[model samples]
Target: MRIQVSRQLLDRQLVDVDGRLVGKVDDVEFALDADGVPYLRTLLTGPGALGLRVGGRIGRMLVLTAERFVTDRPMVPLRIPYGLVDRVDSAVWLRIRAEQLPTSPVEEWLRRHLIGRIPGAGRAGG
Candidate 1:
């Protein structure tokens, strides 16, 4: 199937099989076959990818802001293989569940430093 990367893929929300929010398609990875035909290899998500795709001062700030949360010098983005994508409709549907994916460092940081400090934050539903 033919796809318009910018129009259909980029900035689209990624939804797992369970309908859980995964992330957005911030950037993409491409590879060339033996025949020299380029193909989309991976879908990258997270601030790192978004920042790079955006580029310039605002982009650097975006990444720097997220980097402050994690001890890692350069934050790693969640890379979803194109093969793992079951479909791409209104949103990109994944063949796996969100639990199968690694937790975002930014999210984890917020949970530990901010959200976890909130009263009753540990409890689901009020």
Candidate 2:
């Protein structure tokens, strides 16, 4: 199915089959073939990448904050190759579960330092 790069594709949330929030489509990668024709290479996400695309001071702050989470000076965005996408609708669906991929450090940090501290944080309210 043909999907518009701007509207139906970009900025859409990516979810696993189990309905977990993985992340959003921050940016996309494209590559050229032997014929010199370029195609979508991968989907890039993570604060550093999203921030750079966003630009301005807000972007810098995002990168800086993300750096604190890990020992790496410059963080690398999660690259989901086009091959892994199972389907596209309101959002991008991954063929594999999120547990198979690396967890977001920021999400882990916040959950550990803040969210997890709250009482009954482990339960989901109906």
- Every model's TM-score: 0.93, 0.88
Candidate 2 stretches with Cα past 4 Å from truth are: 117-119
Clashes of 1: 0
Task: State in Å the error of residue 122, model 2.
Answer: 3.3
Model 2, residue 94: distance off in Å is 0.8
Q: Write the per-residue lDDT of candidate 2 for residues 18-81, one digit (tens) a residue.
A: 8888899998988998999988889988997898998999998988989898776688999999
lDDT of each: 0.95, 0.89
* Model 2 weakest lDDT span, ten residues long: 1-10
- Could you tell me the TM-score of candidate 1? 0.93
Q: Could you say which candidate leads in TM-score?
A: 1
